[model samples]
Target: MAKYSLYINSDCSLIIEFEEEISLELSRFILGAKLAIEKASLEGFVEAVPAYNSLLLIFEPKAFQVERLLQETKELLDKTKSLAPSQSTRHDIPVCYHESLAPDLAYVANHAGIPTEELIKLHSQAEYPVYMLGFLPGFLYLGNLNKALHCPRRENPRPRVDAGSVAIGGDQTGVYPIASPGGWHIIGKTPISMLDSSRQNPAIAKPLDTIIFKPISLEEFNQYDH
Candidate 1:
């Protein structure tokens, strides 16, 4: 455990920094602070974002001054630190690694010095932690890949990676939320839509959520996609 120091970034934003390495514990603490502040319903508190080891608080000056908000945030952080890490809902996503869907399968395999079949097995077997969503809307950065399967990002980012593409970049794996330019080495893709703006809650996963992908055949994938 470490002591947190609060600092003012601007009139409306305050940052609480945890003097610790970026890990699951730190992320949970950030989430705890978020939950606490939300529970308090403190006026002027607009939003909160948790990164690897710090929490950023956004507020409105009309409703909260720097001193009041800092005190309120500190109290919430104290309460949050005492609580245990909260368990998040897990999502089991289905993916298909067939030829047409996974263009970078062979490339990643070659880069890792392993056969494509072995690479797929290692990737599918691991249970990954959803670290956070960034890089794009609903784009999840999952961590702790099999060491043997680890590789770097694409030398040249693709003009547009199709939506649903599940790819690996370095130690992290991610699913493209929407069709966009990306560099992750595509190994497979899920049939499920990563994000549907029409939904009441658009993002399928959030911080601290555990995500596992089950391998399916092309037929099964198409069955679900339709």
Candidate 2:
């Protein structure tokens, strides 16, 4: 394992960056690092945010000296590398690709030079990795989208994208956990509630988890909606 680079991102945060590319190994390492750091309960630790290839640690400057924190962080990283990778949960989320649910399905298929059915087949067949959670409370930035389904964000973003909208932007795909302005091309909608305030863990999926899209009929989606 290569040494991860650690640097102070801000007065109260430290960034631990790994390889520049996105891959399962890098995602695992990032999540693992986060788990390790949290388990260590370093002085003044606030939280650990995991990304595709990096982990950000937020701490209180008043509790520990920056120099000492850096040394301790490095030692933690070295020890974490030897520990087993964290286990990841797989989530099967149902989605409806009906015209009403997927307003841009036809356009996306045309843009990809494939039939609508083929595009849906490709999208649903592959499993995606939850690289990070951002943009919204429960929004998951999933990766490993099929190359054929890769498409750029809309030239003009929609002012409001409905929550549970499954979208593809550039090389990634994600669900809009809340209604918000977005530039990604919406391809489907899931009936599942991705974020629930009442739950202990609000987000259904976490970093390094596997997400598989299971296609459902419009009627089935309607039942779920009700």
Candidate 3:
């Protein structure tokens, strides 16, 4: 069987799904395949959007040649290699895990059977890899949350979760770039703007980048804000 299978998503879209579960290696390969497809510049190609274990290819509907494109994609991925993680950048994000900002910190800590301080330490100790950004504007989907910190989303989602809220939902952790209704258990808040519309590149980080949360005091959070 083929490692990947392509399916028509729409008249203008095709999906390439890998026959594997989500993993760092799979993530790298997915990203690498995206870059390779972009470089191929196939006729009618529009963009290649990557996810944990799949890639979505869009094209000009009128110019789409299904058979030709499928063959081309298979050949491209076959010759393509996983992108080097060394080329990725490391982002040290400051997070204030104060009780005032972290409404669910104690809750998550309790669920994990660990003290709040220890929970923060465990959350900050590991480096998370950027998987993809979606489901919310500028929301970065980061992976590698510590198993101890893993907790289910809140039973009732907040009507409005403030931006910069660092949260853990299920097995993932990330910072909300904008205020929106959310169910992720908030454990902290960051002072930096993860998404700034004025900037040329609104998203602070991209796929293949690494992020590390540095715990900061509320006073330090105030300092960063000012």
Candidate 4:
């Protein structure tokens, strides 16, 4: 296990920073550290937010001494070596890649120098790791997109991108959890709802989860609406 830097961020939070690059190894460590910290049940521990290569530990200043918390956190981190990265849930999200839904399909295919069908195949074939969740309530920052399919975000941001819109920006890919303006290039639309405030767990996926995009016909997508 590599030594991670632990330091106070602002006045009430601690930041655990690992290697700067993004990799499965780093992600595993981050996840393990988060789980171990949660299990420790330290006082004033509000939540641990996992990112690609770090974990942000939020706590209440009044509930615990900072020095004591730091010592406890270091101890907990030492135990992370024994903690295996938790088994991540794989979600086969259904996406409609048809022309009507995938407005940028042609553009993306042209940019990749491949046929639209081939682009869809490459996009849907790989199982992406959920690196982090950000930008929106259920927006999943998925990683490891095919090199051939890598593309930059649109020069002009869309005024509004519909919910369930699967998009790619730079080397990362993600889904829009709600209708909002975005710069990512939309490749398809998933029928499955990724976020719902009414549900206990609003987001269907979380950090370290595996997401598999399954291409579905327009008819199949319509079935989800009923």
How many clashes in each candidate? 0, 0, 0, 0
Residue pairs that clash (backbone atoms under 3 angstroms), model 4? none
Over 5-87, each residue of candidate 1 has an lDDT whose tens digit, in order, gives 99998878899888877778777777777778777887888888777677788888777587778888887777776225457
lDDT of 4: 0.87
Among all candidates shown, the one with the greatest lDDT:
3
Tens digits of per-residue lDDT for model 2 on 1-226? 5457998898888999885677777776676677788999898999998876778899987774688889988987787753233567899999999989998999999999999999899999998878789889999988889999999999999999999999999988889988899999999999998999998779998777889999999999999843
Candidate 3, residues 1-226: lDDT per residue as tens digits? 2278889899988899998988878888888888999999999999898888889999999999999998998899888788888978999999999999999999999999999999999999999999887888787889888988889889999999999999999999999988999999999999998987887768998887999999999999999743
Model 1 lDDT, residue 165, Cα: 92
| lDDT, each prediction | 0.83, 0.86, 0.90, 0.87
Stronger candidate by lDDT (1 vs 4): 4
What's each prediction's TM-score? 0.92, 0.94, 0.95, 0.94
TM-score of candidate 1 versus the correct structure, residues matched by position: 0.92
**What ranking of all candidate models by lDDT puts the best one first?**
3, 4, 2, 1
lDDT of 2 at 125: 93
Using alpha carbons, what is the TM-score of model 2?
A: 0.94
Model 2: residues >4 Å from true position, as ranges?
82-86
- The number of residue pairs in model 2 that clash at the backbone is 0
Candidate 3 segments whose C-alpha is farther than 4 A from its true place:
198-200
Residue 145, model 3, lDDT: 88
| Candidates 2 and 3, the one with greater lDDT | 3
Off by over 4 Å in 4: 82-86
